[model samples]
Target chain A: MPDVCKAPAAADALLEEERFQALSSGEAKIVEAAASRIFPTTDTPGAAEAGVVHYIDRTLKEIYPKQIASYREGCAALERNAKETFGRQFTELAPDQQDKILSAFEKGTASGLADASEFFALLRKHTMEGMFCEPMYGGNRGLVGWRLVGFPGQQFGYEDPYINRVVDLEPIAHEMPFSQQEALDGRKS
Target chain B: MAARADVVLVGIGAVGGILASELTAAGLKVVGLERGESPPYSDYALKDAVHAIVRHALHDSARHEPIARRDKEGENTRRRPVSSPTNQVGGALNRWTGQSNRFAPGDFKVFTQEIASGLAERAGASLEGYNVADWPIGYDDLEPYYTKYEYEMGITGADGENPFAGPRSKRFPMPPLRDTAKFVLFRDACRNLGYHPYRTPNGILSQRYKPPMPYAQGIPERPGCVYCGHCNNYGCHVHAKASTLYTHVPAALDSGNLDLRTRCKVFRINTSPDGKVTGVSYFDPAGTVQEQRASVVILGGYLYENVRLLLLSRSEASVHASGLGNTHGLVGQHIMAHEDVRVSGIFDDQIINGFIGPGSVGGRIDDFNSNNFDHTKLGFIRGATIGTSGSGTPIERYNIVPRGMPRWGADYKKYLTRYYTRSFDLNMQPETLPHKDNYVDLHPTECDAWGIPLPRVTFSLHENEQRMHRFLAGEGEKIMQATGAAKVWSAFSKRGSRWAGGTRMGTDPSNSVVNDKCQVHGIDNLFVMGASVFPTMAGYPPTATVAALTYRAADFIRSQNALFH
Candidate 1:
């Protein structure tokens, strides 16, 4: 079990996976920017720290191959919308500017994108899943999401019945004792 | 392999597992057919909320087997995913919330006690298209079987806690689970509001215990529940939950009289011209269509699947021309679904750890359940069982913030970070009345992976359900307010849960599919067990009652000499 309550090294950075499974480098940058805007870093870790982009990438490869075309089309159209509106690529925009475009896509107000609302919904859901799900699934890097909301991941039952109180303890991931690198490296092929 | 057995059961899940064990234990040759693979326990490992909640790893994914759904009878339907039916060995029981409860005494006689008791008139409930009817049997008839199933499956609850529950022949195998501080808060609040709150009966063992009496043979001692915050939608890593997968399935196999076949999808209930069920034809593991010869065939799949198989097996050459046991065109009607209505109260401080226990190991009040309370002018004949609930894992609790909070970004994250454990929810499973139009039929367009038409569920909430939802949600809010919460918001799901019926059992054959003996009316050797034969669904988890009914049916199937002829 590891206590993730300690301050992390940093929260914001474009993900540097060994290689993107489904997304290109540019598409990964845009998706990561959108996810960061969806769960931006205020004072705590956000989707960036949680490696939500990698989650999206992995999910698109394994579970949801059908969604890859939607992601590509949505990302490309989103870039066009960014250039037409903000005069810059989506990843180069300010946080508020990125928020504006993502917000339009969420509410179905964005143009040049088919299933903009649908794409945004999946991105949002996958981002949250990345934030909160186990590290074995390629997200929740270092258990930041669990620590952010005081969630203990898979610690077995307590010895006593003191259930109604703050439980701050060292959190443990499933692939603990073995590094998360095993799962990541294993899925690389 | 084309095989022969004394008895054949479809869908080796909660009910089928019971029949498989009980019949084989009686020295009967039983063959059980299952539609999914028997994956090991490691597949149900804890810590991976993504696999359980998101991927629905233990259950069916809607992407492949979408059941077409519509809100009205004639409306154009959309293909919606049916996620409850598990595609694994244990089926839905492997990932249920494990709330074990018996349908109340009045529940079996809904038509007599409520519809004909003038309660409907008093409440001004319009029963135009509603198909509420009395069950062929009563609580007294099934009390012994309920006791039998409880011991066989190992339930945990105090004998005399739920006053509304019917008389019990014996105490539960394990005592009631320990109360949590969250339960205490809900209990005290219910007491303040003049509600009779009790520890919810659960199938999970309170402590390490084995089954007792004539039913305990071959079953091993199970560990007590650890309250590891992963019960619903996740298999028990500790084997604390009393699943038939571990208990009865193993016991059945050990009897050597049982032959269980997995990955065999039964598409049609095969019958001879004389109208006795010869056996069932199914797609075996290697995609080979095969059949088994049986003196008796039992339909023990989920409610909707039972309906689909019956509809799929219909033949003009058989006694049940319209469908199997649908003698009077009543194979898949009178369906009832339970709507989960909830209210969340936000406290200023962390009142409890919101994610560290079994979903059902908490306080609940049955004061408003069934016809326990008056329905006068309430516009609803039945009520809901309201209780305290827990947020499962982190992903499970991600969307449960207060109303009007943005689903993402700063404010949402802030509220969740501090108040994730501060909020307590009181959920109510409202008793949805059976309507004539809320039925299951074969889909006209959508087909499953097997090239068979999917079962189309036509369902919508009626006034009785709507009124019940509002009243129960208000009552839950009142209890939350009684707890001195800073804010409270309530919601009710449009889609329902705990689906029951589609092969309703009654003494009268005109409107029912099965008789009191669970035999299909015209075809004596064809029996239908499980919630599919439920006359009406009470506002409680249906597993306990479904198991009890299976126990009762198993006894009848073994004892009925006419069926063997």
Candidate 2:
């Protein structure tokens, strides 16, 4: 398998553009738009740049199949709000307009939604999970999440002297950070 | 087909694992039924943060057996997606942070102390309805067992440090795990504020195994803790953390007399027509119902399951006409959960390096725990232990920013980068008094996949507990501020957080489920172990105390060999 951490920009783009099995096309568009606004890119690459939507889509399909319906309902509610407020679908809204709708959803003020706050909380939780989770989960691409907050991913052990010291050690750069499959395979072998 | 054994132990985790080892060593043919399968110790090797911590790979998914919760009686209970304690071979021990602390001497006689000082009444905390009871067994009775469990489980600690600790016959078997930078800061801060700071005892081995091991069956040759940051909520990949799976269960298996049947879920304790426990009925992994007959039965499943099993076993035709040991309808009453209050501090001056040590390898001040402090003026009966812990993984740390910081945005990202390593939390585990209203029973509507009624918890914090939590939170803030933190903030749980109880032990059958020896009242052959038997929760982790009680119960059962025969 190719090293996700060391993959080139073109390969990363291709990985991000891969088809999602769980989310509908419209749902995928809303998720990407909402996630970007939730963790907007500034000086650092945010959720969208980290492929959070892809992570949520894959996780919904594979890991948490129970959440698929909630995601669909939540996205449909977001579309309804968009149509009622601006006479357009959520995907066609500008970045600021998307932010306004998402903020309402977060604050539970979005109309015509069943448990809009619950959906907002779920989306926010998934977005954060995608941001901080290991790169192999299709998010945190290129170790950008770890680097954003200076987390050293899965270091075996910090030596004795390092334990009681205040020195900030350099984070390890993994050529191919082991995915869940690789870790399981290694354990089996 | 029915299999027979000298003893049948349900739930091969902390309490059951210890009993399994002890009873089998005494030549008793023991069968341990565990609902969860015993995965190879190497299966604990997946160190993925998302899988281990977020998804809880080692725990039973709530979809299968969701626990229902409601704050008070007459309220509708909702199914919770996850239970506090996981069900597995080693049980919660596999994922526990290894904070091995003994209940202080005062913890055993909480009711006696409250009456003596009249603090319960004077505080005006509505003490009328609370049913806190003193333990029939005192600290002196369990001291030797505590010492044995400490040494047997390879607890790491230094002696003569925790002056507030109850008298121990001997010192810990292993020296305390190496401290992290945060520990050093916390220690200095505590000492500066006129508190006695000491190393917290933990189950993780500090160094590799030395000769003269405590157990009759010696510990397996394994590496000691390497200070891997992924300790709490995550199983140790290296088998360095001394979970029951790595210690007692393996030792029991080595005894050659223990038949540990994993993936066998005990549904009920089968009783004879003459009011004696005949055996237990369990569902095998393939969904086949199997019966195991034994002279003695021990229930050591997590607190909720232990009570739920008894309630589920109730039938009008049963000899007792009530649940076993539920003649007084007190089988699942007086439950208590430790009021956990966390106070975190952000330091701009120094980096605490919060992620570089084992979970419990931090400093602690026990001077405030139990009756160590004066509660007369404080309007509380008991107190809490203030401690610093080190298993703050990056994902958890991402959410801990100074009070006004936004959860997500450029400023939040900046805050995470700056304070992730420089921040630390001083935790307060306060003792919560049991109220008559706080109890566990079966939910009327919700049922698990096995068709067993989900355990319904009815609990709410007493005013006494709330006052105690507020005081402890203030103390935590003081400690954090004394450390020269740039900003400090506190967080507390709501009124009802069900952590333990349901099958409490005491002297009277009128008020308690089990007796002093953890044997079910009026049932000579049946015993219940673990935190379910705790009359009142101490201001500390209950694992070490549970292990000690299991040791005592095992000895008691051995002494009654004639009953088994």
Candidate 3:
């Protein structure tokens, strides 16, 4: 219906306070903290500004309802390391100390976890999906991920095989190819 | 519940799709059984990378219907999973990458030309414990059917360009898809290296096509591909990809004599004491067991299910004492698949724009495929089909990332920005030789949610195939370097797709499960179809050959006038 008209409700929600589907207020803070350290701020918006935590929160409710408990366990793992090493919960730890805990989890050398690597992988995968997935899935707010990677954005079809030019168009957030407007849409706003 | 039909076609994917269309067109009443229901095709054409590519929403779930996997006989079942062909009405054809290629003529005579003629010996390749057999029928016999399938299925390619291709009856029905940056780079590299490269043949239509078949003309017309990068792992929003779901399945449904039954899981092939199949029993959508009696039966499921049906059909003191065709002990032998490997290259000066085109728009060289080149002193008999192809979605960035770059942090973000749009990968699917060890059998303990014993695939990369993959990855690196890439890395994965073979066809009943006619040995009315009958698979994707073989087999079954009339 309105799929073609470029519905702006998703964009408006980015500026306002967005509701979490699965994660609680405290859990959201924990995930947003980890996602920020995982893909922290640089020249462009990182996971935090891109609302990656919101993506993880919704994905937990939608596609991965089974992993909600594991995600809570992962949050506990982060807090355990933070309290042991830095005397704080994960959200309250400094970015450097948080990075240490996450990097350790990634390397599978972290303590007080059953499968740190698997949890780290899950977090990393969801982080990437949130960072890069089209804004329709509640991530990549403001098309920051597409812009950072020069991905142009989703196109139904490319009339030209070498359409690398910065062409603004709508990303097909729903099903099917929604047509390529010279190239994938790298609309920054 | 009970039903009756002249012919019962099990597994309404590629094989059954063709058989259902053909038998019904010939005026015989036909019933087709499929485990999964058909969805409106265009409904899945969603280009969502997270759902379509990363999550594999279009593919069958491994949690429920996983083919138990073990590397060798004694090893525990490993977590290594081969992507299952979807259980839906269209089968794997629903989501094939649309690379429509035919095996070289030499592929059919591997035993005579490669082994007996001393090519394998000359290569110093051992044939010990290999289950290789010369296909009873060769390329000449299937050429007409290959042409028929191609035209009917709307293949798009310049036929004469592939110098290694067997004699063609006609040009491809449509012109090939447009060449993108990746193809231009790969093609230029091949030309500079003095290798003959051809535009990849594909089932995805390049132009608005009206297929030559009378039956095909009645189905909805197909529009030309719009160069949508969503072609891989996603269905086409438009009916551009020539899947039987759009082609033959619709053709079957259109034929008045056919009954297309979806969500029906066939459990066993009912056979009389005389060893001719009586019919089949299956679970309907409501989980109620139903029987269908027929004069002729076809086992046209994917290779694993094709083998499992015979294994599961056995009962105490029944016609099948061991398995249906296991008197020869070859019902589940010589299972073959690709041992695919890859190499990725990063370009600093130029953006490849790899995300712009469908996976089909690339250059491929057949110089290394089959026996096109000399294998003298080489450690392997079969070779690989090497090409640069794939849609450059964000997920593929994992493969092309600079080796030491972390998956997280500021450096990773910069790496994604720099190399994401400027990288390309050259992938190879090496031809797998039939091996004694690389086979599938019914799992001893595992069962599905329906309590059906899961088919276990006990396959490992054969030493010959492993050696071939190693050499080919080196060649892929060389090709990538020829593209003038700034940096190159090996992105190797031993996992292959489209596991074909298990119930192989040969002339001798003592060593093979079926004959060239695709009829089970010692059983006149029972036929087993698809790539499961492949004695040796070529390096190329086998869908085109599967369609060709099914076309030929359908003709053979139609000639049995007694059953039809």
The best candidate in terms of lDDT: 1
Error of 2 at B102 (Å): 1.0
> What local lDDT does model 1 show for residue A16?
51
lDDT (Cα, 0-100) at A129 in candidate 3 = 85
lDDT of 2 by residue, B1-565 (tens): 6567999999988888888889988999999999876756444555566767666632453456777988888988977766355677788788788888888888899888876567666754556687778899889999999988877777889898999888889878889888787788899899999999989998888888632544655446557888767777777877778777877787789889999898888898988777888899999989899999999999998888889888887767766666888999987888888757889888878777777777678989988888787666577677888999635567666666667777665567677767777788887778877788988888888888888889998888877787888888888899999988999999885633326677889888888889989999988999999898888888898888899999999999999967777
Candidate 1, which segments miss by more than 4 Å at Cα?
A: A1-14, A176-189, B1-3, B57-64
Q: Per-candidate TM vs. native?
A: 0.95, 0.93, 0.93
Best by TM-score: 1
lDDT string, candidate 3, B123-163, tens digits: 98866678788999999999988888888878888868889
Q: How well is candidate 1 docked (DockQ)?
A: 0.50
Interface DockQ of each model = 0.50, 0.40, 0.35
**Candidate 3 segments exceeding 4 Å error:** A1-16, A163-172, A175-189, B1-3, B57-63, B78-83, B213-216
Tell me the TM-score of model 3: 0.93
In order, the interface RMSDs are: 4.1, 4.1, 7.4
C-alpha lDDT (0 to 100) for residue B162 of candidate 3:
80
Error of 1 at B221 (Å): 1.2
Clashing residue pairs, backbone N/CA/C < 3 A, model 1: none
Q: Give residue A118's lDDT in candidate 2 (0 to 100).
A: 88
Report the candidate with higher TM-score, 1 versus 2.
Answer: 1
Candidate 2 TM-score, true structure as reference:
0.93
